[model samples]
Target chain A: MTFVIQLMSGLAVGCIYGLVAIGFSMIYRAMGLVNFAQADIMMIGAFLGYAILVAAPGIPFWLAIIGAMLGAALLGFVIERVAIRPSVARRADQVYLVLLTLGIGIVLSNGARLIWGADPVVYPTGLTHQTLTLAGYPLPAVYLYIAVVMPALLVGLHLFFTRTWLGLALRAAADDPDTAATMGVRPALATSVSFALASAIGAAAGVLYAPISYVSFDMGVIGVKAFAAAVVGTLGSIPGAVLGGFIIGLGETFGGQLIATEYQDSIAFAIMIGILLLKPTGLLSGARR
Target chain B: MESKSPAALALTGIEAGYVAGVPVLSGVDLEVREGEVVTLLGRNGAGKSTAIRVICGLLKPNAGRVELHGERIDGLEPAAIVGRGIAVVPEGRRVFGSLSVEENLLMGGFAHRRGIAPKLDLDAIYTSFPRLVERRTQLAGTLSGGEQQMVAMGRALMAKPRVLLLDEPSMGLAPMLIDAVFDMISTLAGKGLTILLVEQNASEALDVADRAYVLERGRIRREGPAERLLSDPEIRASYLGVG
Candidate 1:
């Protein structure tokens, strides 16, 4: 019964990491640069949702989620245009871009602190605390929602990439920006759309996570764990991101349960190093070069 | 030839290069009329690919003008140039290796607007390259060299390009595959597609083109009908490697 409970809790956390990792993977694939600010973006979304909830009491939880996603998407557009585009146009080195994104992350995190203050805020427990007994074990309703929502989002994303014209254009841009341009697909526009989509998904993860973990200014570090998950899954594969997130989540949970709870974070990093040494391509197959 | 408009693609005084001040091609002029095949013949360093790059708008000319159907497209981006009905099967068969053969063909149609009439049919592409139909789901990188070239050509055709720019379609192919590629080009031209082919394989290029130009040091040294160029004593001795 304890094991089942642990697994359920681990799965919920893993799904959130998977969502954030997918955003990192998408942006990296499209632009060939990791958006280090992704976690800060997720934090911004959570804070935005909190603000909306406070500004207008009695707003439905689902509506808050949608509003947060749209807000994050708009924020993503602005960040891409103002922060990323200039550096890219100059053809800066990869290390420079990485540093730029790290700077952006710091700015966003501090900006969130300025607006929302440096204290943790509790989100209303809306259907998340409700418990259901399965196999004579108590399971949180939020776990079921997380499991269902993550898989559904993955399926929808898969269909979008496979069936939609815009998704096809994004994939083409990722494959070869030069050839994609020749195919009449503007690489810049495709990149903007990729960032927007990734941000919205990250915001969705934020909304789901808020009720589980109280929203705070320092919530962005969770995104670092998501990055570790991305690396475990390989850098760019969507399925790999999800699998890596789940594996990391389980590892953390079990490590805390069996070993010292203080070292749970270390377990994820150790697994990441092990995977990098053993199978750098990740568990899921990804594009070579 | 029947009475028709001027060349589907025409470039006049095209000077373009990578470096800001150093020009790779100086005053390079080329043309491809409707239903005609033209070849640009040159050695490795002779600016053959640069001419194609400039025509396709991949590299903007430092000083020249390009006209497609009489509309100037000298400073336009590559996507805009493609939207003007020209497609290049770029050098090295640069197919999207990560995508499947079918996905690659579908990407070729990205330029067509949402409500516009479909220009190219998938069935036609599959019929043109039957092997592609058999392996539509396979990743493009997994294909053999000849098969990859077929995908590259099929992808260009899917765009329904009025003028096709083929750069060294014969490079790295076996003798049999080279013959197959030439046959495909002839078939496309027979179907009314204008073609500007750039190649180091002078004999094969001359055999397939209606007109030929020999480029040396970024300038056209000779221009004439393919047969005349092929039979010219100077051309035969210096370029054709025929006594």
Candidate 2:
């Protein structure tokens, strides 16, 4: 029961990490930029949902999530246009892009600090109170919600990528933008769409995560862990992101339980390094590169 | 204002290179009429590929006016150029390593399906390349060089382009494979496709060209009918290697 309980909690957190990792993978695959601001977008999403929910106090949870997603997607589009597009036009080096995203992450963190103050905002009363008994262990209802919903969302994304024309274009554009252009897929449009989708997915992960954990400006650290997840899963493959998330989550949970709770954060990264050293492409990577 | 010409694709005064003020092509002019196979023949580093890249809108030329079917297309985005009915089989057989052959071809049909009815669908493409039909499920990265070249050409044809630009289609291929590729080029021309072929294989290119231009150091050294160049002593001695 203890093992199952730890596994359940790990998986719930892993799904959130996976959600953010999917954004990282999508953007990186398409544009070859690691997008350090991705995690900060999650922080923004959590705060936005918190603000909206607090203002009404009667608004449904799902509606709050949808609103946060749309708002973050728009914000992401603006960021891509204002910050990213110009550098890309100039054909700036990879170091410049990485620094630009890091700068954006710092700005977002400080901006959130200015808006929400330095303290952690507690999640809603309803969330902490709800619990579900599974396999003789009492687990948070939010974990169950995350564990179930994230897989479904991933499945939907898989269908979208395989079946839709836009999705095919995105995959093609990622491989070779010059060639994709010759096929009539606009590279500019594809780049923007990738930003929008990545941001939306990152925002969704944030909203889903906040009810289980406290919302804080510093929570972008979690987003960085998601980056590790993406790397662990192979940077470009979608399935790799999802599976890498679970692996990181489970590793942290089990490591904390077995050894020292203080080393939990370090364990996720350590496992990432180990995996990279051994199987660099990740556990479920569909992409060779 | 650019002149309205009936040529399928035309380039005038095209000056371009990777670095500024160090052009590989200076004052290069070329044109391909409808349903004609025009060969750009040159020695290594003679700006043949550069000329094709300029017309394809990959590199923005320092000074040039490229027109397709009487409309200017030089400064347009590469995607828009494709929409205007120009496609390129780039120098390397740059097939998407991760995608299946079928998916690669499907991506090729992207421009053709742009909110309009598609002219060259998957069925037509598979029929044109029966080898591709057999290997449709295979990943492009795993294919042999000849098969990869076929995938690259098949991918280009998915757009049903009005003008096709081929850059060194026989590069790195065996002699047998080169002969087979040139045969395919002639066949494509026989079916009425307008093509701009860039090659170092001077003899084979001339064999398939209706018109030919010899480029040397970013300038057109000579231009004439393909048959006329075929018999020229200078061309025979220098390019044809008939010592």
Candidate 3:
């Protein structure tokens, strides 16, 4: 039962990592820039949801999640236009974008600390309080939510990429920006949309995560773990990132139980390094260089 | 080439290159009439590719105008130029390697907003390149050099372009594949597609083009019907090495 419980918690945590990893994958593929601020963006989303829940006490949790997603998406658009796009236009190197995103992350984390204080705050449990009993096993309702939501988002994203014009444009830009531009798809617009979508996904993960972990400034570390998962899965493959996240989550959970809990973070990093060393292209099949 | 309509694409006094103050193509002038296949012939660094780039809106001309059906397009973006019905099969067959062959075709149809609509049909492309149909599910990067070129051409055709610009379509292909590519270009031109073909393979280019321009150091040194240019003593001696 304890093992099952640990698996459940790990899976939930893994789903959050998967969501953020997918966001990173999308932006990286579209513009060839890793938005290092992705995790802090999630932290900001959590703080926003917490503030709204406090201010309008009767607002439903689902509504708060939606609002946070929209807010984060809007913030993503503004940041891309003002910060990222200009740097790209000026032909800055990838390292410059990395430094810029790191600065953004620092600003967001410190800003959250200023607004909400450094103390961890209790977020409403939503459905997480509910528990499920299976064949001699117990699972948190949040774990079930995570499992369902992650796969559902993956399916939706698949449909978006395959069935929609906007998604096709995004995929085309990701493939070859120059050729895509020649085919009447604006690379800049596609990249902006990618950033917005990534931010929304990050925000959704934050909302889902807050109920389980309790919102805190330190949650940004989870973003680093998610980045590790993305690297493990192959930086650009969406499905790969999700699978990598689950693997890391499972490893961390079991490692915590069987080994030292303090090493949970280290376990995720070790898996990432192992994957890189073994198959540099990642576990999923795709182009890496 | 007897259509009374304006040329499908025209460039006058176009100047462009990669670096400032050191032009690769200077004062280059060319035109392709509706349904005409015009070949741009030059040795390496003779401005064949530069002229194509300027016309395709990939690079802005340092001086002069590029017009498609009488509308100036010199300052337009590549996407906008595509919207104006020009598609380029760029040099080196830069296919989207990660995408399936079918997806690459679909991307080609991205520019054709509306028309007879069959202009950008996948069936048409597949019909033209049947080999691509059999390998539609495969990633483009995995294909052989010749097959990748076919995919690149099929992708451009998916745009249902009024003017198709092919840059070195025969590059890196085997002798048999080169013959096949030239045959396809001739067939496309026969079907009334206006084409601007840039090639270092002067003989094959002349065989397919209705008219030909010989460029040297970014300037047109000779221009005439393909047959006339092919038989010209100077062209045969200098470009064809047949004298």
lDDT of 2 by residue, B117-139 (tens): 34347777778778888898888
Q: Show model 1 residue runs off by greater than 4 Å.
A: A286-289, B1-5, B113-120
DockQ of each: 0.63, 0.60, 0.59
Which pairs clash (backbone N, Cα, C closer than 3 Å) in model 1? Answer: none
Residue B56's lDDT in candidate 1: 77
- State the lDDT of candidate 3 residue by residue for A1-289, as single tens digits: 5877787788888899999999888898888888899998888888778877887876877677778889999998888998899999999998988999999898888888888899999775445476778667866666655666677778888889876667878888888888888888988889889998899889889988887887887688798999988889988889888888898989898987888999999998888998899998788855432
The Cα local distance difference test for each model comes to: 0.86, 0.87, 0.87
What TM-score, to 2 decimals, does candidate 3 have?
Answer: 0.94
lDDT of 1 at B87: 90
User: Which candidate model has the greater DockQ, 1 or 2?
Assistant: 1
- Local lDDT at A70 for model 2: 92
Q: Report the lDDT tens digits of candidate 1 across residue range B124-213.
A: 899899989988998887899999999999888878898899999999999999999999998887887889999988888899899999
On residues A155-241, what C-alpha lDDT tens digit does candidate 2 reach at each position? 878777766788888888888888787777888889998898899888889988998888999999987789889889888778888
Candidate 3 chain B, run of 10 with poorest lDDT? B111-120
Share of true Cα-Cα contacts across chains kept by each model: 0.74, 0.72, 0.72
What is the model-wide C-alpha lDDT for candidate 3? 0.87
